[model samples]
Target: MSTRLPALITHLAHRHVSVPGLLHSGFGGTEIDQAHRDVLDHLAHAVTAERHRVDEAAQTVMRGATTVIQALSHQMRSKIDEMQHRYDDPGLAQHLLGLDHLNEQNLRHIQGTGVLCGAWPGLTHADSHLGDIVAGAQSRIRGYHRVQVTSQMEAPVAVVARAVEPIAITVAELLANALHHTHGTLAIDVSLHQAESGACVVIDDAGVGMHSDETEFASRLLSGQRTILLTELGDPPRTGFAKISRLMRQYGFSVSIDKSSPYGGVRAVVFIPGNLLTLLDEHTHPMSAMAPLPRPTSPTRTGTLPTGDAGGTGGTGEGLPRRRRRDAQPAGHLPAARPDQAPTPEETQATWSAFQAGTASGRAASRTDHLEGNH
Candidate 1:
């Protein structure tokens, strides 16, 4: 009887350790009863079911909160747009632009939260150029000036209407992650490449790369193979990868961060399948496109910041176009320029004016479309 008693206690101890795990992993009460019918198994099953219920309730709350935030953000953006048009003062306009940028970032956060909580990315009825989408995503983040984009596609590629916002959100999250991990002055390189089966937006940063374990975890999250719970995300929870995973499951695109960058950082690639791609006719006008913030008007190469008084042409250093610091010259001195080798200030001013005019036209067209749709 003593030997049998020892064996029985050991068996109970094993069950004690394993039952909670199995129940938490979704083992039903009936399944547990079939294996070992006992009061402990029943209690564990009830506890796990309650825990799942609480998680669902929390997710619903999160979704509702994000929905409210998103609506508010949209209203704020519309007001800002109105103010931008009402004020002609360059100084005030610059401040408004900065405010608009911040509001965009806020909207991104809210959208990401909504996605993680099972809400869809906001609806868009018009298709957007893929390059413009990436540019728009870059503008949504804080380090927009530090990103250098190089597009290598032979022709313009546009994302379908339904997938536009999801792709933008995913790229923005990846860019934000890259920017967050990197330190000051390091540029993020974004290159768009055409793949045989689809197109890829590749982002690379010079920040410290992820460890193997971290990479593996991110891969699992991005793969959508494992279910993710908001409770599992740490304090000030990181929902970027999880949001990307959810979007991938809903949308048809795929993202990968397992590759290392040439800059010794992370190389994140977002591949949009051919089914989601449509060719943009050269003569077609943009439709409800999200315009990228105007880049600093400075004579500098990609990934390099401009130096002294980069406000372009006759512009004062008092607005969003103002550039603060100068970059060092390259090693070899250039030969003296021919008479018309570089663009004259007048020419630069004309180019800048054209760009502004085009942006205003796009905005006006978008507003007209919105009004027409309402009718």
Candidate 2:
């Protein structure tokens, strides 16, 4: 009877261990096992609920941090704008421009964080030309000079007011990624193509292309099929693709980065559907009436300098008067000036002087307009 009792206890112990496996495999067992499975299911659900709560808490903390940074950046930018106005010396003007550019890059990072936390792009502008939108994006990054934009639209294409900022942010992130991966003075080619269905902004780089796995991961992220946590972004946190994904899902546009570039690098294409597009004249607002676009500046080395840096010469070097002409050119076509006929130094200096004068005049006009509007 003692031996039989020991065997019975061992049988009961083995049955208890099998309950969890039965629950996992969705199998039914003895009534006692079923009761054990019910308890285990409840515990599992509790754990999942706790994990969700923690994720929400972490996102809340990140959103709060981004909000604080954004407010500080706005005040700093206002001060920089005032300084830009107070100074007329070319060298000082250049330095002020660099500061402004740096602030813009900082703002991009902050805005990206906010967006990933389910916040809007935060600035609203009147409907704007697609070319201008692309140029506006080009002005935001560290390697603006390396970007060569060519537009092939038969007519002007403008983004609807609702989509303007989100598209610009996506393009800027793409340009930054291209700049980070490419080396030397190789040009990053950005081409705009318009079709009956929509308009596409195609960015091609000259760096080594992504591996199959990297491409697959990027495809999944851009598709917005998977939920991403900030913790999953890896050390130092790359929020670019994640931010782009959020914007893509929220807005109706789509992005594809799965293709290879002719330049032996990755090719990324952003397509804005016809529903989100308009003519330049449609729903247009006065420049002063709309949220001000980022003022064009001479490209300076802002943000982390990617490996194989291009000497950051897209515009005048750091601490130089802002040159709006180079970047402000319409994205639809290349400059008419022949490459062989480079402007003489005297001609270049004259152009710079004219640019500075125009900038001052424009500011004065804007102030006057504001006063008149108030009256």
**Candidate with maximal TM-score:** 1
lDDT of 2 by residue, 79-129 (tens): 876876676566666566667778879988887887888766666665666
Clash count for each candidate, listed in order shown: 1, 3
> Which residue pairs come into collision in candidate 1?
307-326
Q: After best superposition, candidate 1 residue 99: deviation in angstroms?
A: 0.7
lDDT of 1 by residue, 128-182 (tens): 6677778767767886766766655543556777788789899999999998887
Q: Pairing residues by index, what is the TM-score of model 1?
A: 0.69
Q: Compute each candidate's TM-score over C-alphas.
A: 0.69, 0.68
| CA lDDT of each prediction against the hidden true structure | 0.65, 0.65
In candidate 1, how many Å is residue 31 off?
A: 16
Off by over 4 Å in 2: 1-44, 282-375
For candidate 1, what is the total of clashing residue pairs? 1
- Top-lDDT structure, candidate number: 1
